[model samples]
Target: MIERLLGTPYERRLLGGGRFSGPTAWLIAIMMFVMLSVAAAGLALAGSARLVSEGVARRHMAQITDGRSTGAAAVAALRAAPGVVSVTPVPEAELRRTLERWLGPSARDPDAALPIPVLIDVELAPGAAVQPVAAALKRAVPQAELISNSGRLGPMLRAVNSLAWLSAAIVALVALATASAVVLATRSALAAHRATIEVMHGIGATDEQITRLFQRKIAVDALAGGLAGALAAGIALLLISAGSLASAGEWTGGRLLGTLDLTLLALLPFIGAALATVVARRTILHSLRASL
Candidate 1:
């Protein structure tokens, strides 16, 4: 049924290829490029956010203004606390170096008499409640200021999520635009071949035959354009990934494309072509039904 509907090699070309083919191919290519780029960005953003969120959820920080004894006691309490994984007290020298790197030479000067506090990093087991652990830490050292990463990361996570959603929206709009272009192109082809189509109908050509003639031509054009666009988008993405890898100097697991990302990207061209073919077939068939 499918083969018959699409016609065969012996079927004469009723909708002849014309000037629209080249421009239509180029237009689809551009749309595919934009769609793939936006989709890749959205995937990267979503992956990064999940990684960061997990890391933040499992970790908490404490700045202890009290003496070394208080810091040691706080670490002990956290290590023994429910849902606690591990605790590490950052060395004072390391803390001073970090401050100096960020705040300048003044932070390194012994004469400046900066009161560098004791910092303890606590890692909680998965599914731990931050508030309970924070309360336990406070009981151990009242002077210690407990900080939950979730609070600091909230706005940043929200922003990243918003951008990911925006990327999705852009991809959807590009798809809609591609479909619209295919529809208009199909309509133009139908208009251009109206007289020949009417004469075929007069000679006993059924509507299905006429529809198949247009569908086959439209499918070929769509397939050609889709493959071309996919190839161009693939090249652009490769160059982008190469530049990103060069700048990063090392592959951090989340920064590069994963298996799923590569698969989706690989399918972009076929998906675009399929979309164009489907849109064109529907538009042409509908127009034929109304006219004849």
Candidate 2:
């Protein structure tokens, strides 16, 4: 297919003599860059969702509002309960440290320390019903409030998923824009060289040949732009990854790009180039048919 799309020497001499070089290449580059960057962002959002889902699966939190004695009883009850894997009580000092992040150093001062709820982290066995566990825990310790991790983050997860979908929509819009630009450019080039096209037709140059000529030029430009854009996108993503890595312990989730993600991003430029080539060929052929 690539060989057939290559511009013949005769074809170039016959119809490729335009004064304006056009901005197809640069246009394609900008489109590719935007598309790739948006795609990477979508991938990152998806990865975060997956990590959070995995991290929270079958996890539950029990908050005892009564006292430490109630927290101890809840932990003991959870440990002896069926389908419960383990239970750990959050230390008061650790709780104070977490509060310090929001309430400042005053949270750590004993005199000014706020009332802290006793939190027990619970890990349930697979397929355990949260309702049954909550009911049992409620009966065991009335002051305990059982909260499912997934339920707590459900809204946030949905929001992340929505943003990921929006990113995909943006990428699709950019691709459609790229194709539209190619179509307009091809038509303008055809219009600019109408006399040459007529002469080529008179001299036995078929529409297929002329179409291939335009395809070759547009394909080269698109490919060059796509590559440049892809390079820029890659550097940008690398910088983002570097920044994320520099934060080290801040992001306890997974990496931005997995192996599959890397492979797909790597192919984006080639895919964009091929799409532009196809659009250009179709536009040129349709215009030629209309004109002659």
Candidate 3:
């Protein structure tokens, strides 16, 4: 089926001409860039969300273990505290490394070190009152500062949620822009080849055949554009992530980094391609019918 499609005169012309057409090529290039931008933004947003969520959790856990001297004691107290499900103390060395990674080498030096606070990890009961627990921990631990993970986390989560929505909106806008570009480009291509289309129709070419020719041509163009965009976006995202990792030393002291799922990254290209193809096909079909 692929061989036959490729063998067709329309397909051959489209493959050759579409590649050479400066405007059409540019449109594809722009689409690719936009797709990549959206992907990068989405990844960043995800990273931020994870960082904020983890930070909040750690802070809250610290609140639970506030003022406790021994790790064992902190854990035990946290366990006994109302709304606490479990508690674990993060090692001081590990915490130092985490801080170093985020603050950089200069920030990690001895002179730069502040009296580091101890961090305790806590899990809350399913329906626990977070505020009450935080207040209780504040009272129980005089030297130990109580950090309500939710209090710190709520704003970050909201920001991330907003960013996610914004990314979605941007993606939708890009899709619409790509579709419009394809429609206009296809219309122009059809117009330029009007004589050819007329001759084909006059000689008994059916609408289906005409549609298929245009569809096949546009689909290939869209695919190229989508793949290019996805690749560009992926590369840009990697660069951003690398830079971020260097600066932040793994978000949320590495917990957030752990949550950066590869599966989500892998799904991006397929989604871009599918969306591009559908939009291209629809735009071409609609434009062609209107022209006819």
Candidate No. with top lDDT = 2
Error of 3 at 253 (Å): 4.5
Clash pairs detected, candidate 3: 32-229, 36-233, 56-149, 60-149, 63-146, 63-147, 66-144, 67-144
Off by over 4 Å in 1: 1-7, 18-21, 101-104, 243-260
Number of clashes found in candidate 3:
8
In model 2, where do residues sit more than 4 Å from their true spots?
Answer: 1-5, 12-22, 82-85, 96-116, 125-136, 245-252
How much is the lDDT of residue 16 in candidate 1? 46
- Looking at model 1, report the run of 10 residues with the lowest lDDT sum: 245-254
Candidate 3 stretches with Cα past 4 Å from truth are 1-11, 14-22, 61-147, 246-249, 253-276, 279-292
- What is candidate 3's lDDT per residue for 185-246, written digit by digit as tens? 76777777778778878999877777777666666666566566667766776777676655
Supply candidate 3's per-residue lDDT for 90: 77
- Separately for all candidates shown, the number of backbone clashes (residues 3 or more apart, or on different chains) is 0, 0, 8
> Candidate 3 lDDT (Cα, whole model)?
0.64
Against the reference, the lDDT scores of all candidates come to 0.78, 0.83, 0.64
Against the true structure, candidate 1 has what lDDT? 0.78
Sliding window of 10 residues with minimal summed lDDT for model 2: 245-254
